[model samples]
Target: MDVTTIIGLFVGILSLVVGFLIEGGTLGSLLQETAAIIVFGGTIGAVIISFPLKTLKKVPFIIKYAFTASSSHSMTTVENMVELSNVSRRQGLLALETQQDMYEDDPFLSEGIRMIVDGVEGETIKDILNREIELYERRMLSIGKVFETAGGFAPTMGIIGTVMGLVHVLGSLDNPSALGPAIAVAFIATLYGVASANVIYLPIFNKIKARLDDDLMIKELQAEGLISIQYGENSTLLRNKLMAFIDDEVKSESEQVEDVNVNA
Candidate 1:
């Protein structure tokens, strides 16, 4: 689980509630069942109309992905590539076929290696893997779009709810004493809409996109590694080449400081 995501959600809710309390707002004033029903129900109806049923089925997975921290495999991928390079250099490309089991968990890596062992051309390997990556990206992004769609529709739904509430308020104008409370209840729809959009839907969409980018980078790294292995690149040189895929922040801070000291 992602602790930061949990912490951020908690902080956002706590701040809102505490700030409201400080401003002399009651919790009861915020708890309007009618407003919630209108905003959320309308938003859901909009989302359902916007996306297909198949795509909507993945909401649970999308939410789980947003809350979960993705594991970094850059270093492991680099090391594995270097190992494969060494094996191919010593025993020829055909030897990699026997080692396919080692990468079974990663079909992308395994398939690339299999193609290499099958004597696929370097350009063809790159083309096939790149196309696969593109398709994977498109598919994942379409799923994340559910959140994006919801975020967009929520505010509009809130406004609609507020308008509907105001219409009712106008209808009951003779009850002057009830006007302020009616207006307050009507505006709760707007609050729910805006808050849910900002704090939940939109953030989850961005988080899913961030995770997707990470997964794509790993796939690209593996593809590069498999191609390098097929071409009989030196393990040391391949390792250095693959190291470029790792983020600078992920590299050791001590090593960078030591390099500066050595230069000094």
Candidate 2:
């Protein structure tokens, strides 16, 4: 589903195969099940030992995220804030009480709405929202670090597999033909390690980081818009402020609407 992830995998494998072919190697030479088992098994075992069960369970989700574009809630946040601003202007801050269920479903929106509904001052709301954002960012970064660690260790495990293969080759050195196969097996570990690290693990880590950044940006916009609403700013002013989070085309459209209304 993630084109980038798919492309990255395809490119990495293609490059590896091309490089191998250029070096007078064939696919048959690299087909080593024992090497694969060693690299994959050892790396996974080490990862399990390093991380908690709950954290480990999140690996697949993290992998999925790596390939998929982030689900940006900026537009949703802006829409909700615009509605809340209208409600506040029409019926005072207490009017938002009935909409609490909708707000509660979205934690970022819910927290900001709660701050305003609770009569928190704008500055205090900013502080509270910022603190929450920081906490979430830290948690997200920690999750990214887990995949990074996996990427780092995968190659090392591959080397370990290579060493094991070399050991077998050394024992069979008396047979030259056997040495070639053994060496091939040993090198396959390195290939798996490099492929997994470059193609999968590292890319996932970067994707999570990017997604976290986008999520944080959306939360920040929500926080700022909520604070502006809490201070009884005009809907036009609040809308203008929130529009900064959107693209130039959207901003232009919004401004055009304002221009038309002014003429009317």
Candidate 3:
């Protein structure tokens, strides 16, 4: 779980609720089916119209990622790359075939190994990997745009809901008691719109952006690992290079262990 995502969401909601309570507002004041229909329904409708079906299917996964850390194995990936580099240097690139099973589950590792096995040139491999990364980035951005659009539209829809309620109240202005309830309802839409946009849609957009950045970093690590392996760098040297991507504490521990082993 991502602490930042959880804390951010919790704090946003708590602040809103506390502010409303301080203003003597009840929870029921913000509940309006008409407002919900306008904001949520319209937003969904617009999103469906804007994005492809394939992209829409990724919404659930995107939501999950909002609260979860990325699945990239930073330190483990570096270790694997170092191992592959060693193997390639000792027994030629073809030797990687024997260890394919070890990295089979990792698409980035598998792809690099497969390309080497197929005798593809380094430039060709880099081009192919870059293309794949670009495609993935585009798809993620498309998904992120959906949330961004929702954030943008929800407030507008709220205003529409408010105007609609005001029109109803204006028609019955002679009934002062009815007018009060109608005015309250009208304002509810605006509240809901602001709350949803800030707490839900905008946060989702930010989370998606963060996830995309992590993914880009993971891909960069993979690319560097593959290139190091192809160049047949010494395993220890390659490992040190990869360790640069890890946190300082972890890198220190691993370096100390390596130093001890070398001395032994």
The models' CA-based lDDT, in order, is 0.88, 0.81, 0.82
Count of backbone collisions in candidate 1? 0
Candidate 1 lDDT trough over 10 residues, lowest sum: 249-258
Clashing pairs in 3: none
Clashing pairs in 1: none
Q: Per-residue lDDT of 1-264 in model 1, one digit per residue for the tens?
A: 988888988888888888999999999998899989999999999999999999999888888888888775677677778888888999999999988998788788889988998899998999999999999999889989999999999998999999999999999999999999999889989999998899878988988998899889889888888888877788888888888878887667536766999999
User: Order of candidates by TM-score, top first?
Assistant: 1, 3, 2
Question: Which tens-of-lDDT digit does each residue in 106-218 have in candidate 3?
Answer: 77768878898778888888888888889888978887888898888888878888898899889987899787778998878887787889898998898889788877777
In candidate 2 the C-alpha lDDT for residue 178 amounts to 78
- Which candidate wins on TM-score? 1
Q: How many residue pairs clash in each candidate?
A: 0, 0, 0
Stretches of candidate 2 exceeding 4 Å from the true structure: 18-25, 73-76, 245-264
lDDT of 1 at 40: 94
Instruction: List CA RMSD, all candidates.
Output: 3.2, 4.0, 3.3
Better of 1 and 2 by lDDT: 1
